[model samples]
Target: RKPGFTLGAGILPFTHADYIGEVRESGLSYLSAIKNATQYRQISDDITLNAYAAYIFGLIDLAFPDGRPVGFWFNQIKQALYLIDSGLDPQIIANVIEVQMLKEYGVEPNWRGCVIDGRADLPLDFSESYGGLLCQNHWDKDPHRLHASPRAIFYLRRFSTLDLNKVERINVKLDTKAELRRILDVIYTDMVGVTPKAKRFLDQMHQWQDRLPDDSE
Candidate 1:
């Protein structure tokens, strides 16, 4: 999902009564709890996503199962501020924010780690940011090409602890007929410890293939 600001909304199955009872039972200060509940509702109204919306609605119902509807609303708002400040991604943030806004009645402005290595951390978020950054620098748009670039691989290898030997093994396993022969030749000459076993295996396989009946038709 993309990153941006918006109101909140939710889609869950819960009655106002269920929400109210939980509030009184929790023993929180009436004014503070009310504010939290309100914010939760507002944030729930603004954000968009099916799964989270349902969860927030369920949370609200559990929190205030018997209180007045207005009280439930206020409490949600207060909860939203806390959820938003907790570093949730945009889609989740939106659903959670609305639920909190409706329950609490206040808004909190705290969101971070939305970007990684100058790329948007979320799926679509990267499309815009990456595109803009690449265009500005006159770079290619294709991700495969970008990732294959030497500079890109260098940066990735610098940040990651990958196994080069394993990568070589995988490449050898998938090599074309000509490529496989070239790689096998190198292994026979340069590789140590496993060369004898590899050569024996290849020899046996080639002999087995030679014994198969020809199907020229």
Candidate 2:
């Protein structure tokens, strides 16, 4: 198997579908083998989460040739899977990558003390057009500002520098969970200007999973 010796084998581009099949068979979650979990009502959701993990890795695999650092992406993706495998909210992982994507393309938010040179103690506000967090002073000047609660800020800070291992050990409140989703949805929409298909699928699956089993008499 010398280099440039025999055939074009392994030289062609590998499709993501191929990668998904490989991972599915590799026994990570046995997604293709198992139909449902024994006790969970949300097995479909779990399967979708596993697929989402693969999707994230696929994105990172393809992103390297476009000037992304391999090591950085590797770490980030490993952390993403860690978050997923540990049963944490995939939104955290999604926002982590989304934030980095924004920053890489010069769209990262300015969540640092109200967009710099502003009062540090002022209430935190978000301005997508301004590229970060704003204080009451700055937010009031802009008509497009959105409020960010301290709870939302707490989780956003975690996404900024999340220790994937450490985050797996923590729990979040229901109210905090709802607020985080609100803050993240706005941030992502403003930053990217479109809802990703994966996000839509996850949202739909969430709603579908919440329906009670029909008990028609």
Candidate 3:
């Protein structure tokens, strides 16, 4: 359904080569020389999609005013893979990545006050509709505000400038993590407008993963 230059240079940049081999049966392996690279074997669909998340992000970066940096894009890809390799949930990793990028590339949400008015003393509510966060008074005025946990907000602030090493150090409660995950899903869906294929895939994977007796993905 597409034409030449389909998925051009960096577009849909494949995170793994096996996916290509499996899809096209070309008998060519990117890792042919290093036949024993265990890191590339037995990857999960959720993980692959998580890695592909970077490509989606890269596409978004195309609109960056400064013209996206190649190193920045590569670093984001590495961050996603690193979190996955560290045994972190691909979903959470994606959220953290988005939170960080939302600040760096996207609008740094006014976590300090209301998007409509600068009321810096009240609690915050994340509003995807207007972007960034909301205040208690504003939250009262609008019913569509996404849930925002203080801890989640706290960690998101840190994620804006913190490396994965520092990110790993934050002691987040499980419930707070879950809340952050949901909040980010809403934020990303609204930010992108119409859920992205990568996100839809992640949601589908979550449905199945949550069904297991010991589900923990």
How well is each residue in 94-168 modelled by candidate 1, as lDDT tens digits? 223332332132212112212223432332211122321232122335352122233322222221333222221
Regions more than 4 Å wrong, model 2: 1-45, 58-69, 194-196, 209-217
Q: Each model's TM-score, in the order given?
A: 0.18, 0.64, 0.59
Q: What is the C-alpha RMSD of each candidate to the true structure, in Å?
A: 23.3, 10.1, 8.7
lDDT of 2: 0.58
Q: Put the candidates in lDDT order, highest first.
A: 2, 3, 1
Question: What is the per-residue lDDT of model 2 for residues 1-217, given as tens digits with 9 covering 90 to 100?
Answer: 5675432332222211111122343456321222221221232247676556645654454444544457766666666665566576665566567656555434566655677556568677667767677776666666876666776775775577655556645567757766776776776666656454556666766678558575663
Error of 1 at 38 (Å): 20
Worst 10 residues of 2 by lDDT: 13-22
Could you tell me which residue pairs clash in candidate 3? none
Candidate 3: Cα lDDT at 7 = 26
User: Model 1's lDDT to the true fold?
Assistant: 0.31
| lDDT per model vs. reference | 0.31, 0.58, 0.57
lDDT of 2 at 154: 57
